[model samples]
Target: MGIVLNQSLKNTIITYIGFGIGGISTIFLFPYILGKTFYGLSNYILSCANVIMPLFAIGMQNTLVKFYSQCKTDEEESRFLSFTVLFPLLLSVPLILIGLLFFDDIAYFLTKKNAIVKDFIWLIPFIGLCMAYFEIFYAWARVHMHSVFGNFIKEVGLRFVSLLGLLAIYFKWITIVEFIYFTAVIYFLAFLVTMLYAFRIKKPVFQFVIPSNVKEILIYTFYIILSGSVANLLLDGDKIMLNQYMAIGNIAFYSVATYIALVISVPSRAMHQIVYPITAKLMHNNQHDELNDLYKKTSINLQIVGGFVMLCIFVNIEQLYEMIPKEYSGGILVVFMIGISKYFDLILGNNNAIIFNTKYYRAVLFLGVLLVLLTVGLNMIFIPIYGILGSAFATLLSITLYSLAKLMFVVKRLHLYPFTAQTLYSIALTIVLFLLFYFWQFPFHPIIAIGLKSILVTISYVYLNYKLVISKEINQVIDNVLKKLKIG
Candidate 1:
């Protein structure tokens, strides 16, 4: 266990550092620079690209992850990489044509505004194409356990480009429409860089040779496509739907709060990039004991980090809103609802890697489809009267329900549960800290109150964790970090 953490430490730390910049960018710059309309457009465009991404790639991102772990020799790895890339190129053809033909209508249907959506409709095909191949390249990176650079590119690179685009909009160098169109272009460039890095390392050959295991590859790819598409819908479908029903600017406000909430998502994603392939390789060998220990440790570690981030956002949300335009204060509910959901999602630990890497993953697809229908239905039922808050509520309920269903499926079928005694203690600490700080509206300035509450609550959380020690593995980690900091 120590060996695994030690090996992943450098890359994981780099990835987190990048995420730290990206987080502040989302929290401070996005709302401040772009405000809500472009914010919504930014969110809307990415959601659009995400929905189309799996379709264009034919779910090769997941396929690469699952299969790459199984490849034996250098030749096998090369052929697999070639097939992954070539297959997505083949799939993108039809998607590109369909995207071009439907551009006008998709824009019209997604928003009633005069060509706001229509103006940038042309960017979707290119964006979709990028999503497909980048994953193929990123999978090449992940298979070698070289995750940090790819992760930085995957999670942070586009945002950096977007920052440039925001500058163009701010300086009037590009109109809002152009800024939106440039988003798709930025993603394409990001993917190209990833491809360059991929070749630099592996020097991928574009030739496809049939593997002895091609049958297994094809079957898993099919399931991955369905599962990936459905999962994307579960995550991004709300933003897309909001673009359709509510004002596009509303997406910006909600996105601010969502961004605050999504800070918790980064550690999970960063850690997962390293952990998934490792877990898959371990599970492939029937190393259930190692896998279980990993599950508990990941939960505690993610919670410890994620919990603090959530508390900071929870306490500072008012100032966060104060700093943003007054119109965004409506997103307070978005903060609470989305923050809790993201926190819970993080606390699930490696449940996702465990599920997606296993044989029963097809079950996740069916459940995901059901989840989409429920989410859409709920959004429809709620959005008419509640507006933006309604959208947040719908998302919160859907994610919560989806998490519960996934948990039950994993437990009943695999007899695994992420929650344990320490899990409850973490939850208890979260509740106590939140109650103390949530409604207090301290006499101090907003920043100081935020700082004090954050420090005090974090201290309380750590002290309580010391008492229960969560998992023994978790206690050891705390002790080690404390020892490094000379806290002990």
Candidate 2:
């Protein structure tokens, strides 16, 4: 718990800083500098790449996390690691070949409604390849219980790189088209840095030979591919699908709102960096009681953090949108819709890590595939009728359903649940705070208004939680902060 707490704290700071940088780039820089259409085009390309990343990596990232702990010796571990690396290339190479073979057909379909996407169609696979390897190597770092550097690379480094790219476009050092191409270059370089860093951490002695669990590993990887695809489809599929159903610019509008809402999940993302591999190790060692304790603590703590973030976003949404350009204002509803899903996702804690690391993973994979179909189908129907708002609705519905399914599966199979009376208390507290502060406004600039309102919300929210003692873990964190500040 000490290590988890310490590393999660560091990760939380790093992730928020990354999100801060990302928020500036996504919310202000890109849209203002590049214009909405080009911004949407950029988002669409990245979303497309993300949606396909699971397939290209062939689930090696997750497989490495799950299996790496089980190896009997360093030699066996190295062999397992080596296999995870080379195995994905087997799928990625063929994917590249097929993309080339039918490049024109693929581009036509993708760009039918938004032809701006046509020119950048080829960048998707290349960027996806970069994203895939970064995850794989990041997992490589995670398995070694060395996640901070990788998390920094992932959360801070990549966003910082994208920031540089946006600054380049802003300065006229690169044309918009060139920036798009250079974006792919940025990701590739980041991947190389992470991969090299991972090697420095645990220099992979490339053993091309298979580990003894080759059959089981390959089978699990196959299912993970579908599972990973399902996860990404739920996350990024809407942005890609929007390009088909609406103008490319709508994607930009949706991206801003979603990005704002996404800040709620930052704590969970930060915490998961350390918690995931720990969860994997716990399950591997059959530490059920410890695992259950972790599951509950993570849930409550994340709910507290994510709920506060959602509260801030919802309460200040009007003022926040005011800070953005007028064209992007249409996504306010999108923000609410997606924000709820992300908050729910946070409260589930490391449910995905739990499921993926367990033998019951295959069942969840089947469920995930169906949900993916449901997601795509809902998006197709809703995007046409509701546009980006419809995409938001579809995403909210699918992710809620998916999270519910995973929660139930974990409970039913493992007999572990993440809920408690405090969970209910926390939810009720969040609602009260939101209702109390949401309409309270200042007669000032949006920034000042948001700042003052956020302070009020934070004070009230933290005080109530402190009084109620909703989470011992979180309370301890607060106590530590106060101690550091020498405050009562």
Highest-scoring model, TM-score: 2
Candidate 1 weakest ten by summed lDDT: 2-11
Write one digit per residue (lDDT tens) for candidate 1, span 1-488: 65456545655566566666666667667777776777777788778778877877776777787778678888888888888888778767776777668876766786674246666666666676787788778877877767778877876677677777777777879876667778778788888999898888888776778778888878888777777777778678888878767778888877777777777777787778778888888888988878887888888878877887888788778866776678878988888888888888889888888888889988777887888899899888888789878877888888888888778788888777677787877887877888888887767776677777778777877777778766576577678888989864
lDDT of 2 by residue, 172-213 (tens): 888888888988998898899999999999888997997888
TM accuracy, model 2: 0.98
- The TM-scores of all predictions, comma-separated, are 0.92, 0.98
The regions of model 1 sitting more than 4 angstroms off are 7-20, 168-175, 471-478, 481-488
Pairs of residues at least 3 apart in sequence or in different chains that clash in candidate 1: none
Model 1: per-residue Cα lDDT at residue 21: 68
Span of ten consecutive residues with least summed lDDT in model 2: 111-120
Q: Candidate 1: lDDT of 46?
A: 79
Who wins the lDDT comparison?
Answer: 2
Native-referenced Cα lDDT, model 1: 0.77
